[model samples]
Target: MSEIGATPDPGEIKDKIKAGSDRANALKAYVDTVSIKHVHRQDIEMIDLVVKTYELLTEIMKLVESKVDEIGNAKK
Candidate 1:
């Protein structure tokens, strides 16, 4: 357990992000199974937005991981 108001460890955050990315990939796979023409316009739009959001999150996580590596190296 962690103390209230304390920041989470970077490694923990990365683990969580990885789990989330896996979930997002699963969702994308499900989305892919359905035909876009059969789905409602709004639903298709929402799916597209979610996919884009996940892509951005993946990019951000890569940058964060790089920064974490840099920080760790600096400390060495």
Candidate 2:
């Protein structure tokens, strides 16, 4: 293409590219934080496994609340 009547400013183009990269990096980091890729087998009975998993989830919820509190405190 050779219709070079007007072109985007180089600095603007560079800034846009940098902004896109920054957004991509932030998204990747967020995804990494939530990605779980390991599942090890535990030889517990099904009912016991369900109860234990539920308990573990409760504990994790408490931990998540504490983290949110800390982050909120930091923001203030």
User: Number of the top candidate by lDDT?
Assistant: 1
What local lDDT score does residue 64 receive in model 2, on the 0 to 100 scale?
56
Tens digit per residue, CA lDDT, model 2, 1-76: 2247854344454455556555655654554464244433442344345555555655655565566556656666
The C-alpha TM-scores of every prediction are: 0.72, 0.41
lDDT of each: 0.78, 0.51
| Candidate 1, position 45, lDDT | 87
Which ranges in model 2 have alpha carbons more than 4 Å from their true place?
1-44
Instruction: Say which candidate scores most in TM-score.
Output: 1
- Can you write out model 1's per-residue Cα lDDT over 1-76, one digit (the tens) per residue? 3467974466776687788778878987887788867889899889889789878987887898777767666766
